[model samples]
Target: MKRLSTLLLTASITASVMATGCIQPTGDAVSDAIPTAQDVRVNLPDSAGEAPAALGEVSEYYAMTRGITRGFNAGAGFVLVLVHAIVQMPPTTVDGNTYTWGPGSDPLDPADYRLTVIDNLDGTYDWSLDGKSKFDPNAEFLTAVSGLAVAGDEAHRGSGEFTLNFTNMKALDPIEHNDDGDGTITVIYDLENRDGTAASLEMHIDGTDENGQAVVADYAYAENQDGSGDFQFSLPADVDENGSALEDIILRSRWMADGSGRGDARISGGDAGDEVVEASQCWSTSFRTVYETSTHPEILPEAGDVSECAFADQDLPELPGV
Candidate 1:
C-alpha cells in the first residue's frame, strides 16, 4: 500500500502555526489540551531492503513473514492518517472544554466532516471525527471515529494509553474514503521507561477482518537497543475459513541488528487431520535460509542442523495474555 502524505502535511502546518504563534497559549484550557501528533502515533518497523546475493537464496518462510509485517505496517499507516489530520489541524472554534475543527464557516459544505477534541480535565482527552449522514438530508454531525488519549508527563508527552475506534469510519464518511476495518485498536506504550534496551509496544485488536470475519489478535514488538528486535502476532481459531477443527496459529519472527532472522510458525489444524504442525526457518543476513525444520516432513522437511540457528527458543518474544 502507498504511504499517505497527510502526516508530512500536518507537520508542516504545525510548524508554521508555532512559528507564527497563531495558536499561542492564552490561558485557554481546551486549546492547551490538544495533544501533539507524536503523542498518539505508533511507528511500525519499515520493510527490509532487497536482499543481497551474498546472503544466497532467500528463505520462503522469511519472505512470507516479511510480507505479513509489511501488511500490518500498511494497515496502521491508514488509520493514523486520520489521527494526524485531526490532532495537527488548528481548531476553528472552542466552546467550554471542547475544541472543534471544520472546513470553514459553511455548515453545509460538501466536505461536511469535522473533528472535536474535548478536555476531560483529568489528564485524559476525548476526541471524535464526525460527518453529516448521507441517508438523512438534514442530519447533524455523527461520529464516525472516536478515541481517548491519556496524557503523560513532560518527558513522555503522550505515552500511557491510546484507543482508536474505526467501526463507523468507513460507513459514516461522507466520501466513503476510510479503509479501516470495522474494529477498535488499543495501544499501551511507555515512552520513557520502555525506551532503548527495554523498548516495547503492545497492541490489542478486536474487530472484523477485510472479509468481515470476527478477529481478536494481539501484537507485540520489542527492540533490544542494538537494532535487533522481535515481532509476533496470533490468530485464534475460526478467524478464517480454516475448517471446523481450526485452532490458534502463532507466527513469530526475530531479527538481529545485521538483518539475519528466524521465523517460527505453528499450526494446530494441519493437513494431517488436526495434528499440530510446527516449522522453524533461519535466514542469513542476506535473508537466505541456512537452517530449517518441520515436524511435518512432507510439508517442511528438515534441512540443516539445529546448531546452525543463531537464536534459541528463549530468544523469541512473548505475547501478553496469550
Candidate 2:
C-alpha cells in the first residue's frame, strides 16, 4: 500500500536532512558532550534499564518502520522521473502546464508513476497525481509540497502532509508487515547543505493499524559542524495485547563525521518498565549492529544485529529540487 511507501519516503527524507552540509552553531549543548574525534570510545549505558521485556517488539516495529521508510527516488514535490523510464513509453502529451502519462500505463509503477507539479512561481510549488488518474480516483492522499527552509538558511527545504488509507498496502521487506490502518503522516524537511553545515529535519505520524492499535511517532534530527549529527525518535505509550500502556519507546544516537557513533534503544514503562534493550558498540565504526543488553532475552530475539551508524559510502537520498 501507499502507506508503506509514504513511511519509507519519510525515513529517506530524515536521512537526507541529517546528511546536509556541516553547519556551525553559535552554541549547542548537544555538541559539547560529543567526544572529540580522536576518542575511539563511545560512552553508553553498561547495562539495560528498567524497561519491560515486551519492549522488544515495540523497538522492532519502529526499526522495521524506519527501514521501510528509506531510499525513495524523489525531488522536493516533484517525482523525479528517469529519462530511460520516460523514453520506453509512448509519447507524453502536454496540455497547458501539465504533462499527462500515456494510456495503459500504471501510474504507481516506479517507472511510470503519473504526477503533476504546478509551480506557484513564488519560490513555491505544488505536487500531486493527475486528478483523472487512478491514483486519485477517490481523491485521497493526493499531494505533497515544498518551499523555503524552515531555518531561513541557504539550504533548501520543504514541508507537507500525506494521508495514507489502504487496505492492501504491501510491506517492502520481510521483517515489515502491512498491518497499518488508515492514517496521516506529516514531514518537515530542511534542504541539505551543498557544503558542510548544520540542518534540521522532523516528522510526526499518528494513526491506528488494522488491528486498531495506536501508532504514534515523534522524530527529530540535528547536525553539528564537521558533518556529524544526533537523532532521537520516540513512539510513546503503545498498547500491549493486555491493553496496558507499554512504556514510551525511544532510540537515541550520536555520530562523528568519521563514522564513529553511539546509540541506545530503550523501553520505559510496561510490564518490564524502563530498561535499555539495545545498544551499540562504542568506538566501533560499524553501522547498525547493536548488542542485546535487555534483561528480557526475547525483547528482540530475532534482531541478530543492531547497527544504526551510517557508513561513509552510504549515499543520501536525492531530494530532487534540493
Candidate 3:
C-alpha cells in the first residue's frame, strides 16, 4: 500500500528555506469515526538550531471539510497546477489585520514540513467516469489535505519539522473520497514547501476547472463557443516567437464547474473567434489526457496480455486523422 501523503509546494513557499505548508468520514460524516491529530503518530525533523527556535507555535491539528477536500482531490495530484496566482502573499491580511500563518517575517517555512496521512479505508469512493470505482488515497485524501491538516499542523509546517504519515493509504484503484456529479477530478495543492518534504503528491490524477470548480476535463469537437458546431481554427503568423517549432495547434478548455464548484463551464478553443488564448499559452495545453475516469477498464487486462501489446509504442494517428 502507498503512504497516504504526497507533495505540494508553491512559489511563495519556495521563497523561504524555502518554506511550507483532508477529509474525513463517509458521506456527510454521519459517524464521528474521524481520527484526531494528537491520536496520530508523525515524524518530526531532528531538532536543529535556528529552525526550531524561530517557531512560535509547535504542533497543531484540525478537521477536514468535505467541500475543501473535494477541491484538493481535484488538483490531479499536482501541487503546482493549483497554485495559479500568488494571490495574497504569505502574511497577507485576512479580515484586515495581518493573518499570521506560522513563523518567520514571512508566512511559510521550508526546513520542517511533513504531511502525515492517516488512511482509514472505511467504505469506498468512485472517481470513475462510467461507473467503475475503486479505493485510492482513502479518507486521508479528503480529510488531511483539507482544513484539518492546516489548522492542526500549520504552525509546525511553516518552520519546525512536521511529519505527516498516513500509514493506512489503501483504496480500490484510482477511487478517492469526494464525488462530484460529473467525472471531473480535482488536483489540490494544500501543501506548500519550497524545499521541505512532499509525502504525497501523486494523489491527483488530472481534471479541469470551470472558472474555479474542477471537473472531468475532456475533449470534444469545437466549431463554436458553446462546445457545439464546427472544429477548425486559424492562427496569425509569428506565433512561434520563442521558436519552439510550435507546429501542433494545441487547444485547451478547463472543464471545471464555474463559481467554485457549482456550475460547469467548458473554457475551450477551437476554430472559434475567441482568440484570447495566445500561442504561448497553448503550449502548456494538454492535448490528450494523462488519467481518464471515462476510460477505466472494467476488468484490468491480465498482466501478460498488456505486456505483449507491441503497437502501443508507435505514435498512433490522432483521433482527427482517423
Candidate 4:
C-alpha cells in the first residue's frame, strides 16, 4: 500500500500532496467509499484570521484546493488495452490508426472499447478513448498525448512524452460542501532527456472548489543536472467577501539527490504586508520515504504558523516499470 502511494506520487508532484474526498458520514472508512475530490471554492471563513486577512486567507485556500489537478492519471498505464483484456473482450482489431476490442457480452456493445491513436510522425502521438457507458457519462472520453519519446527498458516498455487533458469533470461525481464549485485541471509532463524520467512538468487549474470561491494556480517542477529537482507554485489572489483581491501566494522548494529539500512560502498584496516562512525535509534514501522535516525555521515575526510540511513515509512498491 505504501509503495502504491509512492508510485502514484512519482506520476507527478501534484499527486503527492493533494488529498481528495467529499463530505460524508461519520467514520473515515465509510466516507471514502466514494472517491470524491473536494470543491476548493469553500475556504476558511475570514474571521478565522482577523489579522489583516492576507497571509492567513491565502494559506487557507491553498491548503483547501491542493488536489484539483489529479484523477486523470489514476489509470496512466495502457488503460484501454488492460480494461478490455480484463473483461475478456477479444476478437480485437489493431491497425496503425485504431484499436478495437470486444463484441462484448450482451448489454455491452460489441465494440465496447475503441481507441484512436493518431501518429503525428514527429516523435509524438495523440490517443483517445470514448468509453461510452464505461464508468459514467464521461469516463470513456479521456484523452492523452505523448509530447516526446522515452528510451524503453526491460522493465518498462514505452516511448515518447506524456500528457493528458480532462475537462468539466462533473462526470467524476465529486461532492461539494460549503458552497465549493467545480472546475477543470490540465497536466503536462516533460521528459527532460527521454530516459523515462520526467525532467519537469506543469499543472494549470482554473476552477472553484466546494466553497464556490474562485481558485486558480500554476505549478511547475524541474530537475537539475545533479539529479535533484524543485517544485514551484503560484496562486493568484482570491476574491474577498467584498469581491476584492485578497493576496498572492508563492511557494518554491528544491529537493536534493537524497530526497532532502528546503523550501519557502510567502503571501503578499499591494504593500499591505508580507508573511514569509521557510521549511526543510530529510528523507531516508534507502527506504524511499521522508524521515524528518521542519517548517518556519527563521521564526519571522507574525509569520503566523507555518503550514505543516508533509512527507510520504510509506514503502515504495515496484511499479510496472522501474
- Identify the leading candidate in terms of TM-score: 1
Please provide, for model 4 over 194-252, each residue's C-alpha lDDT reduced to its tens digit, 9 standing for 90 to 100: 55454555556667766567766666656554556555666554413235555554655
Name every residue pair that clashes in candidate 1: none
The backbone clash count of each candidate, in order, is: 0, 33, 54, 22
lDDT of model 4 at residue 89?
22
Cα lDDT, all candidates = 0.57, 0.37, 0.21, 0.34
What lDDT score is found at residue 161 in candidate 4? 34
Greater-TM-score candidate between 1 and 3: 1
The global Cα lDDT (0 to 1) of model 3 is 0.21
Worst 10 residues of 3 by lDDT: 256-265
Q: Cα lDDT for residue 246, model 3?
A: 30
Task: List the candidates ranked by lDDT, beginning with the highest.
Answer: 1, 2, 4, 3
Cα displacement (Å) at residue 259, model 1 = 1.5
lDDT tens readout by residue for model 1, 43-77: 33344544543326676656655665565555544
Q: By summed lDDT, which 10 consecutive residues of candidate 1 come out lowest?
A: 103-112
In terms of lDDT, which candidate is strongest? 1
Please provide, for model 3 over 180-258, each residue's C-alpha lDDT reduced to its tens digit, 9 standing for 90 to 100.
1222222222223334433222122233232434432212211222211111111122222343323223222221111
| Residue 10 local lDDT, model 3 | 34
